[model samples]
Target: MCLNKITLYLLLFCSCINESYSANISEDGSFQLNGYGMVAGDFQSEYNRPKNMTLHADPTGPNQDPRGKMGDLGNSFWHDYYTSLAVTKKWTGIGAPEQWADYTYQVVGYGDKALETAQNYGRFGGLNFLPDESNIWAGRRYLDERINVFAYNTKEVHIDSGIGYSSKNFDFAVGTAQIDWSSSGAPMAAEGSRRIFDLTYRLGLTEWGITYVKELDNPLGTGVQQATSFSAKYTMPNYLGLIKGQSSLQIQYGKGVIAQYLNTSRISVLSEKGDSSVRFTVDGSISQFEDFTVNPAFIYEYTKRDKSADRTTVIPDLAYSGGDMIYGYENETGIFGGVTVKQNLHHQNISMLYEFIVNNTRNKNGVAGANGNAYKISVGPALQLDVLPYIAPLASLTLTYAGGDREVTLLPKASEWRVGYRMEVWF
Candidate 1:
């Protein structure tokens, strides 16, 4: 039965594509196609040494012996390709407006199909429903608007769709998604499904601007969850010559029942089982200085089980631009970087950056100190190239050394080095 359904869907998709192409050829002179391709490879290694400690050491450890040394290595590679084609027409005879229509299709294939270990390699096409003020009827009324929707369907289709009125700042959207482990050749206890309703309101309060969003989610075989967020920004009046640019402050806070599937199994043991928890997040940014900006944020998360435990974090980031040596630094209490620097390049559009990161965390037992505490120092050189017509290339190389207490049975002191390179092309 599943095979029959799949065959029917594929046949329908091909028929629609052929019909659309034929109609475009009859209405327009020609069509254009464009796309890009990329391939990447990644390699990782881990070295761990345990110490003689408790009897039932780490279950995740390679061996039952807590005082043992182990090493692991893994590598993966993947490729992605995408293409888009569009047909356009010009109005000449009757009283008609110029119009254009496009249909894009993309597919990605991979060698390893494992959900956690497999590499992603496809470009999902977006839906664009407006070119020259076209109209479509949803239920009964004629809806004349612009619509854009994008989704990723590797495991389950995660969709984000919305319709805009163009003249007014009001929009509404509904989305549904399902995750099937069978697609990835994996066993599943039960299939997961999610449905969401989103409403956005944008209002112009005199000179200030305000935006509000309400999101509600309903999961299959589960209860409903909802969240509300609001943000407002106002530009202060420039009375004197103290401030040059606009200074604005924004705040957002949301509290709701977090979806059980959204939690990671590695983070919480109860994540695999059906468990409920309340979560809240409050964060904001402030632009007070003309050339300098400061952003401080905090988060407190708690989960309930047989016992309740909570974790809190604070981060402060400072950045300064329009200077000889641009400085940017961020510190996440004790766990992340405390300082960083960017030295200007000589004669070229290149720069070098140096950063220091410290991570510290404490467990509920208050023993073994913090599980994921470490210190990392990173230095990298970045180059920005504007080679030809409307094309720019950015390349960077970074090297980091992470050292600190490791999670071993008894002696947990290990250090490692990592080197990475990144390149991007934009047009």
Candidate 2:
């Protein structure tokens, strides 16, 4: 049979199996199944483009220019679909025996045009050792978070075994996972393996609470990676004479080794092999204002590689939301700042955003700084419909204007304009 016929048959078989199994659960045990499916389509347009900017243009370019006509629009389109199903069963033992399990499956399809576009299919399952205790014992979990077909990739799975305890004041969990990383993304050595250990702790205080998580990853063929993150918050009590509301301050820091097995030519190297980086973040918010609120955050990151290079970044953001209007702006290191404002109406919601970035560097080998300086501005509006309580449709129309100056001999300046729309539904 044809490929399309095979896909149709497989979908039908899955639906029938779900229906048959859902009806077979014992009445004494509670069973529930839930699922959702979504489809999305997108289109883009641009202008004043350089030859190198075209998707299908020749790779060799010293003076490539953008195609600028109706047929030369150089636009490509694709659609995607995603679906997830979850099942849970709970049972109470009359005497002393008890057990429970939860299972979920997710599937993603990238394009309606080609089979090679199929992205991923995932399955997860969790089992509990005891089902009838105030602090029940939970044990086993298996997850396949990343899966890809059309390649030699098999399947990436993680098996986790852990213990968890919960209390009114605090909760804690410790788990160890074995990861089969070979089949994770674009395919690598089949013997690749990773071992992970994680711990989470929570403490409650009179005025606030604190939470922390520490995780470690050791790969059999690679290096060891570690990450630690924490957050704390404080709230004001009404009993205090002048303090009436709540305010929170949170901070987090993390540093670790980054790993990748993909070919460098085919991947964007965010960090070099055996590289280490430190990240610091701070966030604060206050609810003292009656109808309006303000939030501000800052982040700093520094990275160093064993042999290649090093870099640093800083970002700051501020926002205010209340009434019918919401506004925010963000400034990123070496990049542009962005500002946005939104207005809400009884029947519709509208918003606009603008961004401007400048890139300048003395280094001649760097990818971004190779260009003298680049700036871009984008503005758009969005609409949301609340026709039903559980169902709402969203649509966004955006206009993007971008330009940059390259010191290269061929193409010195480039610019473009693009438009796009999107819609979504949820329950």
RMSD of each: 14.7, 13.9
User: Which residue pairs overlap in candidate 2's backbone?
Assistant: 49-66, 50-65, 50-66, 51-64, 51-65, 51-66, 336-357
lDDT of 1 by residue, 96-121 (tens): 33332233332322222211111111
Off by over 4 Å in 2: 1-42, 45-85, 89-191, 204-252, 258-274, 282-298, 308-342, 348-381, 387-391, 402-414
| Candidate that would win on lDDT | 2
Best by TM-score: 2
lDDT of each: 0.27, 0.29
How far does residue 386 in candidate 2 sit from its true spot (Å)?
2.3
Report the C-alpha displacement of residue 402, candidate 1, in angstroms.
2.0
Candidate 1: global Cα-lDDT?
A: 0.27
Candidate 2 Cα lDDT to native: 0.29
Worst 10 residues of 2 by lDDT: 145-154
Candidate 1 lDDT trough over 10 residues, lowest sum: 145-154
Q: What TM-score goes with each of the models?
A: 0.44, 0.46
